[model samples]
Target: MLSPGDTLSDFTLEGVDENGEINTFTLSELTDDAVAVLNVYVYDYSPVCTDQVCDISELEWLGINEDVNVVGISGDGPYSHQQFIEDNRIGYPLLCDTAEEIIEELGVLHEEKDGLRRVPQRSIFLIDSDRVVRWKWVAEDNWDEWDSGPIEALNDTISQIRA
Candidate 1:
């Protein structure tokens, strides 16, 4: 499993930005001298996942320091992500992992969602400019929903990193 201090894998993915624009996002964009928060949610429209995604955006205090790129990833396609973003007024990039490729690579696949196993477990990774994952969190139960804890912790971690 990819753990803290481990470099994230390189991958190009289609995602919906805050403006609902479709764009190609490469992991290297976050690695090339940028701090990032990579959030993996199960589905786009689900209640818990929605809360998890939006929570990261609503935390304005985190922006009191350096900018941290907040990117959300899910098995949902770009279209679905766009709608989700519009519906919730989200202001971040939400990436698609429809093939579960990145989810599998991250080692956070829920493993029991589809017959072939594609759903991603609710998780978060705090990766630094060097691509090293500084912090990691994965839900213990697939059914459990995420609160502000992850993003709040992310905010705190960002503060520490920029300090």
Candidate 2:
């Protein structure tokens, strides 16, 4: 896992824009915002994963922190991500890791189900403007069970940044 102050590697991924158009997004473009919470999930429809991403969207700090950005990522295709975002009314951006390149780059690709590729692990990375990892968390066994008090954790990280 990456630690605070570690520079994130340049990675490219395919995602769907708000207009539902296929687009390629690079790490550089992603970190161009103020702060980003990169939530990596296993699949689109999974229970735990959905809660993690959706609840994060409802985090109150995001509305107050103008410089904060958040994006959910999964190995699924853009079409699936698009529909999932729409159905769930996901307010933030979702990245379609169709090629699994970002997952591989982040060293989280898992070989589950004998031959199928599964999400490496459930984790969230807080990246700062300079592309340095500021904080992170990894779910033990299931993402749904992972809880650090969303608002509290986010508040702590943001407070640290402000200090």
Candidate 3:
């Protein structure tokens, strides 16, 4: 499992744009001068996931951090992600972790919840320009008591960390 100050492995995934066209997210690309907010979630249109994604744009202070690059990742394929983006008006790029390779590699896989397996645990990672994970949160369970989106808690932590 990754920890604070541990640099993450550079990984790329097939991403999708608002137009449903093929997009790509290479972690190395964002490490130059930005703190990337890795928004990892479950299915694309799942209720909690939908609310979380929709609420991201409301995080206006994201600009407070140096160049916030928000990327939403899930097991949903590119097509589904495209639809979700169009439906939810997600302003950020969404990566399709259909094979769960990245999820498993990061050890954030929420296994076998009610017979469903390979669900990407609702988690977030703040990868600063150094490519180091400066802050992270993995819900002990699903998003029930754990609000996994980029909430005030994360913003406060990031502000303090970067201050």
Candidate 4:
């Protein structure tokens, strides 16, 4: 998996914007002039993934840090991401990685039991304005959620990084 201090390569993806419009975006554009929290998940509407995304959406620190951009990326397609956003009232953009290119590049790709399905291992990346990864968290298994408490712990980490 990508580690802290590693520079991220730029990649383009089609995603559901905060306004619910599907548009193509590049990593540089997303992180421009700000730090970004990239939440990489297995699937769009899965139980743990839903909890993780919602917790992030409800983060109080998000209101305080205008320079921090939080986005979720998953192997689901743009339509699925759009529906997930609308259904959950998610506040941030969610990127589609249908081709699995981004997840493979980040070393978080996972294959299902049937060996016909692939997805990302639940992961998070804190990338600075310069595209250097500042911090990261990768779940050991697909079911593993945040250990230090969900929203508050993640908020604290982002807070410390900004500080």
Each candidate structure's TM-score, on Cα atoms with residue i matched to residue i, is 0.90, 0.84, 0.87, 0.89
Candidate rank order under TM-score: 1, 4, 3, 2
The local distance difference test score of model 1 is: 0.82
Best by lDDT: 4
Please provide, for model 2 over 1-163, each residue's C-alpha lDDT reduced to its tens digit, 9 standing for 90 to 100.
5777887887777776545667777777767767778888898888888888788877777668777777788878888988888788777778887677766666566666566646657778888878888887766665447565754776689688877
Q: Where does candidate 3 clash, by residue pair? A: none
- lDDT per residue for candidate 1 within 1-163, as digits (tens), equals 6798788878899999889999999888866667878889898878888778788778785355345777899889888988898999887899988888888878898567457865788899988887788888898876676666766676677778878
Query: How well is each residue in 46-115 modelled by candidate 4, as lDDT tens digits?
Result: 9988988887888765667788888899878888988899999998999988898888988889787679
Question: Candidate 2, 99: how far from true, in Å?
Answer: 2.2
Model 4 C-alpha RMSD vs. true structure (Å) is 1.9
Instruction: Give the alpha-carbon lDDT of every model.
Output: 0.82, 0.75, 0.78, 0.83
Candidates 1 and 3: which is better by lDDT?
1
Off by over 4 Å in 4: 145-154
User: How many steric overlaps are in each model, in order?
Assistant: 0, 1, 0, 0
- Candidate 3 vs. truth: CA RMSD? 2.3
- Report the backbone clash tally of model 1: 0
